[model samples]
Target: MDLAFSPAEEAFRAEARAWLQANVPNPPLPSGDTKDGFALHLEWERQLFDARYAVVSWPEEFGGRNASLWEWLIFEEEYWLAGAPQRVTQNGIFLLAPTIFEFGTAEQQQRILAKMASGEEPWCQGWSEPNAGSDLAGISSTATRDDTNGGWRLNGQKTWTTRGAFCTHLFGLFRTDPEAERHNGMTYLLVDLRQSGITVRGVERLDGDEGFAEVFFDDAFVPDVNVLGEVNKGWGVAMATTGSERGLTLRSPGRFLATATKLIELAKSLPDTATPELKDRVTQAWIDAHAYRWQTFATVTKLVEGGHTGPESSMVKVFWSELDVRLHEIALELLGPHAELIDGEFAHWMKGYQFALSGPIYAGTNEIQRNVIAERVLGLPRK
Candidate 1:
């Protein structure tokens, strides 16, 4: 397959590269997950928004350049190659925004997309609960109808929400029909975290970042207008967001490629540590990164040709998550004892390795993904 970009696409890549080179923080911003870092990252996000690079794939009316999927891929490649700051609004732009465009009403689109693009109202995913981590069908959060109040009353809790404590809004599924079980009778809700009956408590991660949170709702009120898609038929809507989460948008190949490039440099810097076995691992990881990039291009081709991702997204989730773990593991090995240092040049590898360890666990664990690929994609018998 020809991987060459068109002339127009190359021009777009140059433009994105130039902007990112000029705008990405020189000293690099802190992890956007932390409080002080979140504030700083918001400023960077606004800079991207002002430059019309925040959501390149989105429509111009919604603060984007109306770029195509190929251009979006080009922009991602440029964005990561320049070592830009992590996107603080990723949960919304990468995961939830596609769902909103596909499932949201005209008013919902206008009201939410612009602010989301500008980082005025960042969003966090609210899919996991204490009882419903990978088994999302077991979600127990309830959204009782309040016809007189013209909204729904939400109750229950969401745990392990990325940036939950810092986000202004949440998009999640709730059990709307008491009699409906499992995947049935759920409603996707757009909730404000600052409401009176809601509570958000930050959870400190292994790296000492308060990146995750537990959000609780006790009769939290969300208006009827906030219900995304048809009420009590949210399973389909939620799946759309999950597909984006697990598939193309969330973990773009550019991220892995960038890390792979860094891994190569780290290996070159430590000649003594580069054993044959380690060398093989580094070569294989680099090859895997390239393979992933090509795979993503193929997927983009299919998508551009009017194809939609279904359970095939599970294959993507498994490949990229494992690739991330492998790439970071090699980096730490290259660092040797220096990996233990929490400051200076080696710190990022340690921090990245720690975060990479969670990749297989989140995004519906590799085990579950394999099962989905088996049953849904390959048509294997479940029993």
Candidate 2:
């Protein structure tokens, strides 16, 4: 298979590259964690929305350019190349919205997707509990019917809610049936962050940024309509969300490839230290990233042919996450004492390492992903 873009695809690439060159912020924008930074990111999202660049692969009626998956990949490559600020609404746009698009009602689509596209309401994922991280089926968060309120009364704490503090809504799994055990009697509910009896406390990461939070729900109310799919069958429906996470929703290979390029640039700056071992590692990072990019193409092709992807997403997850950490590790090694700086051109030297280390932990830990590959993909017997 020749891995080259068609002429039309190349034309599309030109359009995307020009648009990104014209639009991406110079000196980059601030982190979305701060209030002012968030506002700017939100406006930036709106700017992309107005240009139909925010979600290019979605249907045109839902504020997209209606581009094909290949075109979407092209746009992403250009976007990352431009060093654009990360999408402020990624949790909603990537993780939650696909589930809604696949399993939600028409009314739900009209109400939610429109707002999401406009960046009027950002969303957060609420999957992990203090007790349940990788084994998401073990979450004890409860949501019982409230007849008087015509909704569910949610009560329980959800920990490690990524970007929870900046978001206006959260989508999480709640055990709707106390009697059913392990993946049974669960429901996926979308909760408004501003609701009463709910508290969100930010967790400062190793980089000293409050990017994660723990959300406490004390009889918080969510109308029945906010629940996705059948109350007790949410476990099955949630695969759509998780599948999106691992497949292509949360990231494309472009970001990793860009980082790999940055790594090479940094290595060039340290020519004295770019030994054979270091050179080999940098090349390996590039190869891994390219492998991921190709694998994504195969996955996309499978989807286009109406084929479903399953445990293999776990493989991609492990590969890319490890690749990320490895890339950052070598970057710091090249930086030497410059990596110790908390502010400067080398500021992210440490921050990137910390962030990349968390890669294996979140979005389902790499250990769990290995099990998924062994059992589901290879049909290995469980121990």
Give a tens-digit lDDT track for model 2, residues 1-383: 66788999999899888988999988878777666778899999998999889988888888987787788888888888788888878888888888988889998898898689779989989999999998899999999989997999999999988778888999999999999999889998989989788999999766777888999999999998898988888898887656663333736888888889889999998999889899899999989889889888988877766777778888888988999999999998888878888788887668778888998988888999999899999999998
Reference-based TM-score of each model = 0.97, 0.96
- lDDT of model number 1: 0.89
CA lDDT of each prediction against the hidden true structure = 0.89, 0.86
True lDDT of residue 96, candidate 1: 88
| TM-score of predicted structure 2 | 0.96
Measured by TM-score, the strongest candidate is 1
User: What's the distance in Å from true for residue 136, model 2?
Assistant: 1.0
Off by over 4 Å in 1: 244-250
- Cα lDDT tens digits for candidate 1, 1-383: 77689999999999889878887898988888899999899899899999999998889999998888888878888899899998989989988898988889999999999999899999999999999988999999999989999999999999999999899999999999999999899999999998899999999987789999999999999999999999999999977666552233646788999999989988998999989899899999999999999888787787777776778878988999899989988988888889888899788888888888888899799999999999998999999
Best by lDDT: 1
